[model samples]
Target: MANYYIVGLSTIIGLTILSLLYDSFDMDMYNCGSTLRNLVVTAPHDTTREFSSKNVTFDIAGKQWKDVIVLVHIQKTGGSNFGRHLKANLMLEKPCVCQRGSKVCNCSRLGSEKEQWLFSEHSVGWACGLHADWTEMINCVPSMLDKFENARQKRRYFYVTMLREPFARFLSEWQHVKRGATWFSSLHMCDGHVPTKKELPLCYKDASWAGVSLDEFLSCPFNLATNRQTRMLADLTKVGCYSSLSDAETKVKMLESAKENLRRFAFFGLTENQVDTQLLFEDTFKLKFMEDFIQRNDTNAASIKQEDLTVEQIQRIYDVNAEDFLLYDYARDLFKERVSAMRARRKRRIPS
Candidate 1:
């Protein structure tokens, strides 16, 4: 009778264990996302007023800020992709809460709202600006430093631009806005997605395509290689391009100095080749972007019109951008080294 009682008890325990295993194994899939989303509601922060999908400037400010930065956009060197990446990944991580501010991206009313929703975010502490006009940027530099310095705390990192080799970047620009066939939102200026003289950006329309013939225009972009030094000095004068450069080397040196300072600031992305305009950011930004990223911006290969230009015309186009390539080549290596140093510094600060 005792043996029978022991066997019954063991059988009951085995059945109970089997029932729990069957119930838990039925479906492994789960909606963990809903649970996570609920956490945001309880965190005491509001996402509605704080984040604007339409606010491009906020796209710059809301990201993981590093004291002060200026995204010196070079026409088609993946600036949009970088901008998108900044907003979704970095800014979402570190949002702005300070209400009283004067920077372009930083607004008074929005900052207050952001502060209320600050509980909603874990923003990295710092403010940076994006820029286009070199002269305006230079003038603002001292003040930018002042703004960061006046605060008791400041971020150690800062930077400005990421330019590709001129030739490659120029092609990327050409490919980028081919109008209707691809996903360039700014392409709205064109009809059927083709860049007419009217729809082109001012930089491209005014200088690059002005005097060139269609055959020449399609074969290669002209005048894209106006040296950085020449442009910087030329922009500062009351008359842009009217300001005479006293010495080319002096201008070059000044740019070099500025770049060195902003070396910490500027994160340059390059086009790998002049003709194809492939990306150089994988190694530089230390992040590998997916194809949909490239497909959205440059899709020229999809519906390309073949032009059998002579080797000479191709060389001329190449020559026009040779200076940019050289500059990019030199800068890329230095920038990589600088980036490595930054990573090293960060690793040292990490607690063992």
Candidate 2:
């Protein structure tokens, strides 16, 4: 980040007031502040890995690389932490999230991506809260595969994302947007984060007081209008949720299952697993800096208004986030399977 240093003239606190007054939209609030003009001159990604006493080179574009893996930040799943970490770690070009029409596209500016890879010194780690479209995996993968094969000699990038339990995410969303008069979080008009990560709990909370719930809404067929409804649900299943937290039988099973799910994340370096952040960075990225980079609380502080939810309210959350539930569950299973495979490989090397 030498090329991307803070212009420490004066006006340190001066900038803070300007940002608050403007109510800026920033993906990485801590590091980049409110500046959208992210600049870093990357010159040839040349990094070697030492895994198991082996030295391997990281190739990209024409040198060492694969498709840029971006984490679509859905509201509060460690978005600021993730964005700052990504920019600080990865060498990305002009990564931009274009909001065209209703869909939000998280991508690098055209042409400049190649320049960043060709001339830049490290890998470009692009991340943002601009909502992720995994279907991009369907289209973008094909276009990038050929280039990736030549550079990194790989056809895929490690598309990584961390998710939270749906109901929790929903509660958080509802509480967060309720106080603000922002129209984006309104019922008729929704923004990027709502559809991708959190559920439309603003209307739910308001509606629930009037006996309206997502379960009632989701009872409708998941069509284009309801697609966001289902997608919102998909993120919750990663942590598992059912109708009642009062279900002693199901609660015990789910709590244990959640722990099991988190246990495997150690293999992926995902913080959602409650693994040591340093272990996560060192293991996955194969590098370490600012070992104590952040205090343990990746999410917001306790004093912040949280989405106060009843156990029954959770099912409404699940119903809304159903789509994210599918995606989260699929990814979670894949993550677990990969962890198993890694363990098996280690076992094989254990002198058997």
Regions of model 2 farther than 4 Å from truth: 1-67, 89-114, 117-129, 136-157, 181-271, 274-285, 292-312, 322-352
User: What TM-score against the true fold does each predicted structure earn?
Assistant: 0.44, 0.42
lDDT of 1 by residue, 60-150 (tens): 2333322233444445555555544433332232343233442223211133322111111112222222223344444443344445334
lDDT tens digits, residue span 1-352, model 2:
0110122212223333333453333322212311211211121221112222212222223233442333433454555565555545443434334344522233332443332221111122221112433322223333343453333333223334455544344444444444342233222212222333232223333433233243443343321222232232122332232223223333233333332223222222334553444444444544445424454543433333324434444444444344334334444565555455446645787984
C-alpha RMSD values across all candidates: 24.6, 18.0
Q: What is the lDDT of candidate 2?
A: 0.34
Model 2, position 294, has a per-residue lDDT of 52
RMSD of 1: 24.6
